[model samples]
Target: MFQHLLVPTDGSALSDAAVRTAVTLATAFKARITGLHVMPELHVFTHRIDTLEDTQERYAQLAERHAEQYLAAVARAAQEAAVVCEVISVTHDQPDEAIIRAS
Candidate 1:
């Protein structure tokens, strides 16, 4: 039986489907689920219209908001299934690498 499941989502339809499946499995196994959202690092180019700091700040805020929104799906599914759920978000250049690290 699985003790925990990690579900990474980007708020896409496919990812939402995966979250539902994971929640179902977790409920069946009485396992916990961790929802992970990896936000990509924002690269600021000097040629951009906005200031470098401003751009980075804006990107960070947007990324954080999106991450919360994406992870909420997993949480909601788990809640409906009466399964334990945890959510986390991190910034990384590569999502695959971030997921590996999380595991």
Candidate 2:
């Protein structure tokens, strides 16, 4: 009876299992799934200007890449099950709060 499902993932093995389960349920209910990943906000302290910029840039790139990689699992699972899927990513200091907001 569910029209839409929200699946939060962190790229963990446990999370992967949850994604599969969610997909199964969505398939049964003919529902669409939304996959969400919350990335930690980067915190760094450096005196060198170049180092700070480099670190921030690198962290941003890595965070985006990781979010994509983590959400890809959900996308693939949904695709295999022929279930519609959407993905979202956000940077937050508190992941639990982010998830709550997303829900």
As for model 2, its CA RMSD to the true structure in angstroms is: 1.0
List the lowest-lDDT window of 10 residues for candidate 2. Answer: 45-54
lDDT of 2 by residue, 1-103 (tens): 9999999999999999999999999999999999999999888877777798889899999999999999999999999999999999999999899999998
Best by lDDT: 2
lDDT of 1 by residue, 30-97 (tens): 99999999999987668767688788898999999999889888888898889999999999999999
Residue 9 in candidate 1 has what lDDT? 96
RMSD of 1: 1.5
TM-score computed on alpha carbons, candidate 2: 0.94
